[model samples]
Target chain A: MNWLKYIGIFVMLLFLQVFLLDNLHWLGLVHPFIYLWAILMLPIELPRWLQMFIGAAIGMVMDLFTHAPGIHMAGCVMAAYLRPLMVAGYVQDIDRMKGAITITAIGMGNYLRLLAVLVVVHHTIVFMLEAFTFSHFGFTLLQIILSSLFSYALILMFEYLRKNT
Target chain B: MRNLLQLILRYSNFLLLLGLEVVAFVFVLRGNKYQQVAAAGAANVVTGSIQLMSDNIASYFRLRADNAQLLEENARLNAEILELLNGQTRKRDVNDTLSTRNREPLSSQEAPYIRADLDYSFIPARVIAFSEDRHHNYITLNKGSRDGVTPDMGVIGKDGIVGVVQSVSTHFSVVAPVIHEGIFISAMIRKNDYMATLHWHAPNTRRAALEDVARHVDVQLGDTIVTSGMSAIFPADVPVGIVSDVSLGEGDSYYDIDVALATDFNSLRTVHILNYTHRAELDSIQ
Candidate 1:
């Protein structure tokens, strides 16, 4: 994998997340977490520990901006820890791939399923921890489901655009 | 020892996950306990600087609307000045009659009480960041401690009260805006002088509730609400909002009134921090 390309993508995604998506509150329910694209697209061969560390770093930076420390970090690290299992289930030859992960390499259906799974896991954990209790369990679940759908659509659109261009 | 080493090696990834999760959990716990002030402050400084840059870019897009609002405020002030000037000629006669009607004569020691004057100075600031969608919304101002902005000072936009200053950094300060659930202001109905407490029900930016006004008060829709000046933070008669709805349930002693907030938090960009010079004196006496 070209490290420079990933670094460039990381920086771009971070700015996009902080400046654009983070500020958006669609009907006060859907907050698109598009920054996860960087973690989600890391080379499959990357070490598990390194992936977790990177995810933690990215999530902490996000937490810094959103004024909620550690929430994003915990969620992102959990997603990173589970990413290998998700990818392995879809892409059997991930080890032989020499480039960064792209939607075209895996079929769109598998790619979207992987994205949906990661986003659902991340949003569920993040929103649940944010609520901190089951007092408003239904509302929290609504937020998780709505935000996951919103984020998945956005990430899918972003991936499609990137793949085409 | 060999078995233990094998067990650790076999689940090293899980162990690392647990270790990272613990670190993250510590952050969550500290954040929940409000022990993460240093981190939050540092984050504020960094995000404030970035928000300032973004505000500079975004301000250009809002210049037309801001100019219109400024012009409207200026016109209102000019009209007020004209009214005061016109009332100056009749003021002496009114004062003479009022003094004669008084039960006691004016004394030199009591002269300060007769003269109406405000003790606050306004520090102009630009809002670099504002959020209304959250349960706890906050506004970040460009002015900070270096600029003589301190905590507990009142902030108002051109139209009405914004919030109270919560914290300050070297170059920035955070305001606990009126939209936040925790904020409450002592407000009154401008028509009948009935006092009430103004509070925001969470997740709503356009409206707030004026509580504790007795049911018998002649609270009507469209009545103006202004700060009662009971607290030293805001001076008397600053417009807070207008009554949008009034309701009472059977057996309830207090009327529930909804107010359409005067300051639109969504478009709020510039504000003035009210610095009451006599706040310390007032606090000491109290």
Candidate 2:
């Protein structure tokens, strides 16, 4: 039943993103990155290797829709590889956790920590791919910062709503 | 040796990530023209839909401005017609008689105005959406190939040059606006007759730079710039812009001058597509 729910969420998020939020641009460069929801809501107990595989699949699908080749793939795999580390780094004592990876299960502070880390890592990878050449290093950094700020804010707003409702 | 192996194993994921990034880079670099066309087309559709949605919301806000500008332009055209009626006007012949004479029989009188002879004329189109983005700045017009629009036709606004038709569909066409980096216009100084190419720098829409003018040509600030007619796309003597500044490039002989374009593209709503009568013959020869 939980597996079906996850699939439902994935399909819904992808459709909303590809159709609705895809064209909204903020600050001329920043866009609502609802595609990252696929990575953000993955199972905490999933094996590290399997998580990486799922991340790659989602990223490849996003790449197909965006026509951005491997940018999403790079971001997703990076987030997956770091997910375990970020969770471990945030939760000092795993024994104190009664987590099913649900919105209410994970405490708000720790949840935000994981979200921030993944958002940063994913945005960095995506921005670097967009700016393949390092000649405009300063501009690339600015783009990453601006885009990540808006994307992170949007994701947090959605999560906040999920927590309340 | 054991420690080295451990380090490699620990960072293996990073290495894999690096490898994947390299592959993506290669894919983008080697992406075919068809792929680019598909991506651009998709992006255009997405933008077009968004513009269409917002256009409804903002249509009320723009109606008054659009109406006033139309009235002003109508009055200007009416004044020009009145002047022509009074025999005080010097109208240039639109026909390509010089080139036609070379191919066929000799004629002394200049060719008659083709504009009056053509039964079919262009449909004035509204620019529904446009881009000022640095890399690719194209415009989506309300009319397209179905309206007799075709690639290589010239687009002109009330004040001056807008761009050329790049692609066309049934109800819409994309223009490569003069503000785009890829667009170039054959322009000349009206005072001294020195010719050069005009191009946009992407950062500014109001101004473009002129190139290939010799340093010795007499020039001044506010010198009128016009189309050369060297290219069949734009008719000769169409007002392009006015010279705002002039300077010499370092270690270069040609003078570089800044021109303030006559047409304010930011506020441009209606545009006319200029179609040369002899376009088919010119294309066949070329």
Interface DockQ of each model: 0.48, 0.22
The best candidate by DockQ is: 1
Which digits, one per residue and each the tens of the lDDT, describe model 2 over residues B85-108? 554223224433433322222110
**Tens digits of per-residue lDDT for model 1, B190-263:** 88778889998644588999999987889889999998889889887888999999999999999888999998
Local accuracy by lDDT, each model: 0.79, 0.68
Candidate 1, superposed: residue stretches over 4 Å from native = A23-25, A91-99, A104-106, A127-143, B1-37, B89-116, B186-197, B211-223, B228-230, B246-257, B281-286
What lDDT does model 1 reach?
0.79
Give the clashing pairs for model 2: none
- What does the lDDT read for residue B177 in candidate 2? 80
Q: What is residue A17's positional error in candidate 2, in angstroms?
A: 9.7
- Candidate with top lDDT is 1
Candidate 2, which segments miss by more than 4 Å at Cα?
A: A1-165, B1-36, B40-50, B88-121, B249-251
Q: Model 1: clashing residue pairs?
A: none
lDDT of 2 by residue, A1-165 (tens): 277888888888876665555545333356556678677677767766677778888876676545445667778888877876666665665445432344465567877777777888898877676555576577667767877787778788877777688
